[model samples]
Target: MTDSADTLRARLTEAGRVCGGWCTVHIDFSEDRENPEGLAESRRRSVRDRLNRMGADDATVAAIEDALSTPSGLPSPFSRFLLARDGEVAVDEAVPGAARGETLEVGVLPRLAPLIATGVDEFPYLVVRTSRDGGDVAVHRTGAFFPESTASVEGRTDTLHKVKGGGWAQLNQQEHVEELWKQNQQELSAEVDRLVREVRPRLLVVSGDVKARRLLLDAVGQAARSIAVELDANTRSDGTDAARLDAFVAEQVAAVEQRDRADALDLLRSRVSQERAAADVGLREVVGALQQAQVDTLFVDVAALDGETLLALDGVPWVARPGDETGDAEAVGEVPAAEAILRAALLTDARILTATQQATGAGAAALLRWPAASVTGA
Candidate 1:
C-alpha cells in the first residue's frame, strides 16, 4: 500500500539477518471467479495449517491474516507478497501480474527472489492523454512498488471553439480562443515538468487531440521533449482506446528493459574479459563481494537456484555453503539459496537484476564496486 521504497528498505535492512522463525507468503488474493470468498478462506487455511505445523506463533499467523485481508493498491489480477518476522509484517506488496501459483514457506530466510522478479520495476513512463484545452497524465514512477499515479489538467470550455461562421467581431473571439488554447497548453506543460522532475520517468508518452499534443509538447521543457513520444490512437477527446494504449506502454517498457539488460550483460562480460574483476560470476565470488557491501548490482538466475539450499550466518556477508556455517556465525541455519543471496543483495543496497539460467551459470553473480582480487586476495 505504501509508495515509498525507502520505507521497505529501512524495514528489511533493520532485520540485518535472521536464519529461521520467519513466515513468507506469496499468493494470489485476486478475486476468484468461481468462488471468491471461499478461495480466500481456502488459501488462508492452507497457509495457517502449514505455518502451525512449522510452529508459527499466534501473532505471526494473525499478522499474515491481517495482511491478506487488507485490500491491495495494485490493480486487479495481481498477487500479494507478505513477509513476517517476530510477529510483525516486515514487507508487504501488491505485485501487478497474474499469480504463477501459491507459495508458502516458513522457517526459511524470506523467499525474496520471487518478490523481486514480480515487484521490481525499472522503466518508468508517463502517458499523457491530451485534448484541445488540457489533458490527463498517468505517471509511472521510476523503480516503484506501486507504479500508478495520476494528475489532470482541464481547461475552460467557454473559449474552446476555433473560428466559426462570423464577421470581424467574431474574428476577435477566434483570437481569444487561440489565446486560451496557448494558455492551457502552457499550464499543462508546467504540470508535466513538475511530474517529470518528481517521477523521473524514462518515457513521456503523448497521446490524444493532435493539436493539443503538439502544443503541449512544445510547451514542455526541453528535457521532457527529448523523451516525449507521440501516439496516434485517439478514440475521442474525453477517452482513448484502453487496450491500444496499454499495449503501447507495455511495448515501450519492454524495449527499455531489453536494452538495459543487454547493456548490463555486455558490461559484465567486458569487465571479466578485461581482467578487471569488476564483475564476479557464480556464488562464491559474488557472495564474497556482497559480504563487504562491494556489489553495485547483483544478477541472479532464480532457475539455477531452484530447490537449492544454502547455509546462512547471523551477520557480515551472511551466506555460507551447508556445513560451512559453524566457522563464524553465532547463529546459523539452512535456507533457500535464492532467498539467502537476494536477501544479502537487498541488505547491502545492491540492485538486483534477475537473469535467466542461460545468462548466469550459477545462482548469483555481481558487478562490484572494487576488484574481486581485493576481496579474494588473488
Candidate 2:
C-alpha cells in the first residue's frame, strides 16, 4: 500500500516525534561493536539503567524507554557522541581539588580587622601579638591556621620612676632597678602564668618601659616567652610601636612559612628523579588540578591584596570594591585571578610558599604535594 521510501520517511517522522526534547548524554565503551542491533539494544538498556541510577522518576524512565524503541529516523539512543575532553567534566561533581591538609597564614592587625572565630576546627592554630604605647596598646593577632608555629615579642619592660610612670621604679641604681625589676618580674610572672593558664596565647608581645617588658616575660616565663629585645636610640614607644609588633608577628610567621617552603621544595626536588613528574601552569589550571587530586603544593603572592580578600578563601564571597545593587543584579570589581588561586590553596590546606627568598633555589611561592607542581615558579 505504501512505497519503501515513503514508509522510511514516515518511520523517521514517528521516531523524531517519540525522541522529542530529550537531552544527549555521551557514554564511551572500551570498544565499538560491529552489530548495530546489539549495540542499539545495549544502549537502550544502558540508558535505562543509568537513568534509573540517577533517580529518574518512573514516568521519566518510561518516556526514555519508549523513545529509545522508536524505529523512526531520529537521532537514536545508540548514536555515539563526542566524549568530554576536560577531566573536570568527567570526574565526580562533588568535591574538587587534591585531598591533603595544608598550613595557612592569616596576618591581622587588630586595628584593621579584629580576630573573629574561624570555623575550621581541624589544622589551624592562633598566634596573637599585643603592642602598646603609653596611651593605648594596638593588639595585632597574626594567625597561623596550621600546625607547628610560635609567637615572639620585643624585650624591654624597663620603666623609670619618672613623673609619666607614676614614679614607681628605682631606675638609677643597678641593684635597685634589678631588685624592683625582680619584684615586678615576680608579679608579672604570676600574671603571665594566670593569662597563659586562662587565655593560653601561643605568644605574647609586650612593648613599653623596662617594667612592662620584664613583667610580661615574668608573667609568662622565660621559656614560654619568645622575646626579641628592642635595641635602638630612643627607648620611647610611639606610632612605630605597631610596626614593631607587626615585625615580631611577621618574623614568627616567616619562620613557619620558611619551614613549609623547605619541606615542599625538598619533596618536589626528590620527585625530579621519578619517571613522570607532573606540573600545572596558570592560576585556574592549578586550582582545577588541585581539585582533581593532582596538585601537591601551591605558591601564592600576597602583595597588593587586602587582608579580608586574602582570608575570604574560607567560602565567603569577597568584594574588592563597593557596588551598586539593582533588583537582582549586583556589580563588583574583578578580583585578581592569582589572589583567588592563592586563597584556594590556603583554605584547602595546600603547602604555601612565598616568592621573595634570597636564594636562587628558594624563591618560589607555591603549594606542594606529590606529582603536580605549580606553573608559577613562585
Candidate 3:
C-alpha cells in the first residue's frame, strides 16, 4: 500500500511540475464577507517573500500579475492576498492585440486543494494545490469568466469558528455550512455598502459541499457575484502532510484531466469534420480545402518558428512556398499568420490554438477558422 503521506507528496510534486513549476492557493471568503484585512495583507506579503526565497522567477511573477489584474474577470482582491514562495504570476503579455486572457501558477499548497479538483480548461487560469509530502496533486482549469483568488493571513491560521446562534447546534456539516453562509451573506451585504467596486466577478470556487456553495452564492449574490464550488472532503484542519492529501486529491485531478482531454479532442474532431464537409458541399475547390482558400485562419505556435504563411477564406493555414506567398494573399507573414489565426478566431467569435497538441498531451494550440470577421467570404 502507498504511504498516505508519501502519496500525497508525490501528487503535489507531479502537479507542481505539470503546472510549470508553480501552484496556486485560492482562498474564498463567503460572499459579501471580507477577510481579516490586516491579517490577510500581512500573510500575502510573507507568502510572496517566502516564494521568492524558494527561487521562483519572472514568468511566475507575471502570471500572478495576470491573475490579479482587473481585466481578467477574476474575483477582486479583498483587503489581503499572497503570491507565495513556490510560484509566480503575471499577465500574459504574449496575447497578441488586446491582452484578453490571464494565467497563474505557483508551488502547490494546502489552501488551493479545492480549486485543483475542478479542472476547468478554458481561459488559462489554473489553480494547483499539493499535499504534505509534496506528492499529492490537484488542478483546476479556468477561463476569462473564471479567475483565481488566493488568500493568506500572515500572523493568522485557518481555523473553523463554529457559528454561535440560530439553533445551529448539533447540526451536520451541511447544516453548519448553510448556517455559516447565512451569517456571511449579511456581512457581505454590509461590506458592499462600504465600496463602489468595479468589475465585480461572477464566479466563486470554494471547497466543501452544497452547503458551502449555497452559503457563498447567497452572500455574493447580494453583491451580484456568481459562484462555482471546488468540492473537497478535507476540511481546514487537515495537516499539511504531502502523502495523506495526495491520494484523495489525485483521484479528483485524474477525473478532471479526463474531461478536459475529451473536450479538446471533440473540438479537434469538429474542426476536421467541418473541413471535410466544406469539401463535400462546395462547388469550387477553393471553397472547401486549404489549397482552395476556404481556411480563414491557421493557429501555429508563437513559441515555435513556423515560417511565412497565408490564411484561406475559411479558417485554415496555407503555408506558402516563397513566391506562392504573395499572390491573392489577404494576410501574410509568419507572425501575422499566427495573429490572423488568433484574431480571426476571435473575430468570427471562435477560439483557435496556435499549437495543435492537446493540453493533456503536453503542448497544444488552437487555430481559428478565419483571419477576421471582415475578411471576404468569411
Model 1 regions more than 4 Å off: 1-12, 15-20, 73-75, 119-124, 142-149, 164-173, 235-237, 322-331, 375-378
Q: Candidates ranked by TM-score, best first?
A: 1, 2, 3
Which consecutive 10 residues in model 2 have the weakest lDDT in total? 108-117
**115-160: candidate 3 lDDT, tens digit per residue:** 2222212321222221111111122222222223332212111222
In order, the Cα lDDT scores of the candidates are 0.75, 0.36, 0.33
Top model number, TM-score: 1
- In angstroms, give how far residue 93 of model 1 lies from its true place: 1.2
lDDT by residue for model 2 (1-378), tens: 112212222222222122112222333221234785676678669766775565544564555555445543322222222111111111100111121222111111001100011111112213233222221222222322122433333334565233323333433445555555456445545544544554444444444555545444545555346533332212234435545654555566456555655776665556544654554433444545544434456544433223322122212222112331223323222334444444344335444444433321332233335444443532
lDDT score, candidate 1: 0.75
Best by lDDT: 1
lDDT for each residue of candidate 1 in 132-159, tens digit (9 for 90 to 100): 8778887774435344778888887786
Backbone clashes in model 1, listed as residue pairs? none
Residue 265 lDDT in candidate 2: 61
